[model samples]
Target: MTPTETTTDHPPRAGAKEWIALAVLSLPAMLVMMDLTVLHLAVPHLSAELAPTSSQLLWITDIYGFLIAGFLITMGSLGDRIGRRRLLLAGAAAFGVASVLAAYATSAEMLIAARALMGIAGATLMPSTLSLIRNMFHDDRQRTTAISLWMMSFMVGGSVGPLVGGALLEVFWWGSVFLVGVPVMLLLLVVGPLLLPEYRDPRSGRLDLASALLLLAAVLPVIYGIKKLASDGFGWLLIASVVIGAVFAVLFVRRQRSLDDPLIDMELFRNRAFGATLGIMTAATFAMMGLNLFVMQYLQLVHGLSPFRAGLWVLPMTGAMMVGMVLVPVLVTRIRPGYLIAAGMAVSAAGIAVITQVGGSGGFDLLITGTCIMAVGFTPAAALGTDLVISAAPPERAGAASAVSETSNEFGGALGLAILGSVGTAVYRAAMDTDLPTQLAPEAAGVARDTLAGAVAVAGELPAGAGATLIQLARAAFTDGLQATAAVSAIIALAGAVLAAVLLRRVRAGEDVEPNSDDTAAGQVTPNVVAT
Candidate 1:
């Protein structure tokens, strides 16, 4: 069919019922995002009860994100062949069951197994939610709004995680954090069938078992390697895992090229808009998450706020982001998305510039102001960039397309946390070694060099005079490291903004650009497969 003919056949815009369903579908996405960070607050409690070994302690906290990131593409494609709603409902069921298992686990191994299962189920939720949004909102304008709201849900979940985890811990055991998923997933299970429309690719072939395994092989090892590098500096085994992942990734792509019905829609990337927008989203996330890691610690260790209070301070930044996300869809009706994205990213870079000036206990205003500004600026890039990615793809392949966007996001976040965090840690460790008090023992000095938290812990093991002196020194060194990291993050954001402006210049808002002109637009609208 011609582009005009295809566009004419599209479904009507969604109504109030569809809007309610969108709200309902957002629950799983929120829950999963919250699950990623909530465990940090529960670690002490969980360790005290489960008595996990040092390595097992790391696994208990990290394995969920690792598996979720690895399986996103696989689960997204699985949703396409089997059915989006069906896959979502099944995942909700599994998530609820696993949450209960995790809450009551008797041993470290049991909790790890439960968390691993939760991760697999969590993987199914994100792509299905994004793809469903793709299928639900037919008009470009309405779809942009829906996508922004969906993205905001994730931020809301993240913003609330520590507060909610802290609250639950006061009255309940460590397992209460795990149980938070149960009620949310149970609600999804009950409401999903009635509200969610089913979507699957009729032409999608049998499950590509070998390719799926290869995808897992490609993602899991590399992420594990990165995590190890972040936590333990570097090792030969960790380096080997990254190399293995690179080999498997090449094999996976070659396998996809050979298949009649490949797991991912490789042609989607042929659209310049699709490729560029994904890159922008990835880079934007990397800058934000990388810098925010240090920002979080600065609020706690440098400024001496409690963990829960630190979370409270973060609320303004995320709140500003949610506000900006809601506004971008409306703004894009008049402004070209390319320009909007470029401008927003530049503003975020400006925020990073502000962050670089932060001092040890002297620039709290600058810190909050800069970060909230960054949140406001970066929010538009995230929302509009996602709109462009979904807009660029064929409707039938929404599940796979959404997966690519989501997978890039996860990869960018992981890369940011691993790399930028390591940089800050390295600086802190070196600075602390020089700042150690003369009264400190050799083993105590070594322990204090690892982190600000370790410094505090080791100080508690010392005489009162030495302990106070060590804390003053460690906090100062950590603050210096944070400022340096902020400078690097600012550079990353600025460089990325310049790239976005150049690459996305031809793309415009409101979606009627010529499809054949690759540089001018994302893609032509196709006939809708189902009504919302």
Candidate 2:
């Protein structure tokens, strides 16, 4: 290649500086992901210290995800306009400040507000990281390797959040969980400018404020609705919120279609590879997310494991996922991408079937084993599906494509939590009703029947014999709920595997070109991936 020629056509490989930048990017990816689940393990401790009402407690735990999902698209496009590196650095600064505020929060309200701010900052971080990968790595094969490592970082952070938080909480205050991000962010702020190159779209238009608000209006209400359904079950208010949000979503798309520079070029969805890959990603996430929520509770309440132990137990699954991600990128050079993804999901479906065997009676061995298998099965889809999504997009529109991929996963998580969480809660309530100790007063029985956690708390105040009996039955009831949920997840995963095989059989990696296609039409590339 000529000295003045860029690597858009021919190969221009990443050097040592680019490799160092990937390491730098991993810091924020790991921290953001760790922050997402770290709060879950801190809930009991923080509730005691802050004395938040049930409602306030829910906000503290949930606000970060809600805001991050809501803002991803806007921030993604913003990066293309203003520059990815600039947006990343700005988000890191905001994230560091928010972390400190959250750590020192004196009141529940203060913490909730701080978490919300952090969510906004998190939105800015994700797309910029992925989009920068698209810009930095010009070669197809090298890009895949980069993305796998990046994806692994996020998975590792999520998998170990409890372990890290548990070890921290064992000695430090609950606020210590929030403090983990401070030093990481400070390091990124210092080293990022030195190693990371800036990339921006030369033809990008000024951001449309009205369209941005419309997109937020479209997303936030639906997320609020889903969370409402998860926490309180379906209601008229919840139904209305979802319907209204759908209307706004339609309006947002219509606005995009009219703009000279749309927030997201609608043509991206027309490519079969892009659509199919995103579909697989969404289904896989939807299946796993609900399972994760209930399993965490099961390990803590039923098995009575400390936070660290529970986190350690979850690592086999996460580690398998990490291994699978790296493994598939290498395998893709030999096997067809579609076949690999479809086969992976099929294996996960079988694992989900095995997970249904998890009962109240010493079933943890099966639970851990099945989930590890399931996680390994999921690796191909996570790694290659994202590869297709980014690779299928046109270079200028990579930011929008990255946002869409992340948004699909977020929406999948919300959908899983809302539908399956409600189902599991219903089953637990019904099953526990027959199992609660008869000698308990009506008030105590009511609390006991509400949830396994509530039952455990109530048992603590009972006589020794009654407490032991209540604990035993509550665990059994919760286990029954988990079995039903696992069955449903299995069905979802199987259906995804079949759909993927059909839709993407002809779609191979490193072979897309779109000019009439408005978004980035991917040809081939490498990886940088995350949610947190």
Candidate 3:
């Protein structure tokens, strides 16, 4: 089929300018996703400057994602009603303003609020860039190539975020890192109007207020619960959060079924390609997020590296991702995507297996070797999974579908941290039992563990023998926990690869082709595939 024969939701004649618009819109995605990991590197500085309470520090890093998870569907659907280009610009402006709020904040609470607002704004950018790219690219080869680069920029941001944040922290304060997004947003805002075409769903209905509320009600508590699990462990609060999230989730699904224009088209799951691809993406994200969190902590605390040095050590992973992004587009022409994902997963499993052996005694060399191998092994799956999500959805529903993809990304990260983090904490506490100063009041250990500095301080006040024993226990416990987590993640990655091969076996090359929207102008119509 010709380019014009497959174009949908826009003029069939998109050129290089349209591609530029797609790339520029992706900038905000990079900024938003980058912020997710960048804050870990900045935590030490933020704590020193703001003296945020333990809960407040977690909020500072997590609120952006929390709000994004809560509002993604509503905002994505809204973009389909209003012009996507309009919403992208509006979201960019909001993001810029939020960045300003975050940068100038005098208190931790203020910064947390700003990040939440930025999440709401950031949600708008992700779906718009992806759906817009689907609108712009018609030829299968060109679309594959475009989606590859688009996925690259977003993943690259994630990989490079800690490095960039660390570099900025070396010279400037923690707040300065928030300002890094400003220039990129400006470039998007400036170029968006000149090159991007406007698009909206003419048939979109009124925003369903009840469904939106139910969505926020559902996602927020679950994410909160998971985050709590990471910090604490299994408890009443965690159980309640899970229960409440489930209740809201039930309501949200019911509302979607009854409503004329649902926030999510429930029927989209019937597409095998779309459904299985999302699963792969979600599972991949779970492994990546868990690894990133533990490795950074291990690098800084146990390895005795500065935040800047820790970030620099993550470069191999980032470099591997860029290489994978560049290579996958070319490889897709000859090999099936399912096989690509499987091969990648096998390699990733091997890499994570290596991490299982790392201990407190391991140096940066060990960290680099493990993270680099895992990154190379996993990059192909991440890049391919995203491409599949975009290619599987119809044009009109692309925004909603992309929102689902990002939600999986956000939720996977949140849950991975919660579950794996809890695992780590439990092991740490377990191994340190009596060595954990029962002598120094309960309040002291609680306060000390809350801050790295406080933890170090408490070590000083203890008796020499007790303090040395305590440090030894803490290190041993953490290493054991991390190794266990890595083993589980490797198993999960391997299982996911097997499942993907089974689910995607029928997806032949060029299955993404669709009848062009211009076919309507030419008085031809295509048959629709019914949901099974």
Choose the strongest candidate by lDDT. 2
State the TM-score for model 3: 0.88
Please write out the lDDT profile of model 3 over residues 6-92, one tens digit for every residue.
334442455788677767866887887788777777788888989999889878877888888888877878877776788889999
Q: Which stretches of candidate 1 lie over 4 Å from their true place?
A: 1-6, 9-11, 510-518, 527-532
Candidate 3 clashing pairs? none
Model 2 lDDT vs. the true structure?
0.86
Would you list the rank order by TM-score, best first? 1, 2, 3
What's the true lDDT of residue 333 in model 3? 81
Model 2, which residues run further than 4 Å from truth?
A: 1-9, 435-439, 513-532
lDDT for residue 281 in candidate 3, whole number 0-100: 75
Off by over 4 Å in 3: 1-15, 40-58, 107-109, 434-457, 462-469, 512-532
- Higher-lDDT candidate among 1 and 2? 2
* Clash counts for the predictions, in order: 0, 15, 0
Better of 2 and 3 by TM-score: 2
Q: What TM-score does each of the candidates earn?
A: 0.95, 0.93, 0.88
lDDT of residue 352 for candidate 3: 87
lDDT of each prediction vs. the true structure? 0.85, 0.86, 0.76
Sort by lDDT, top down from the best: 2, 1, 3
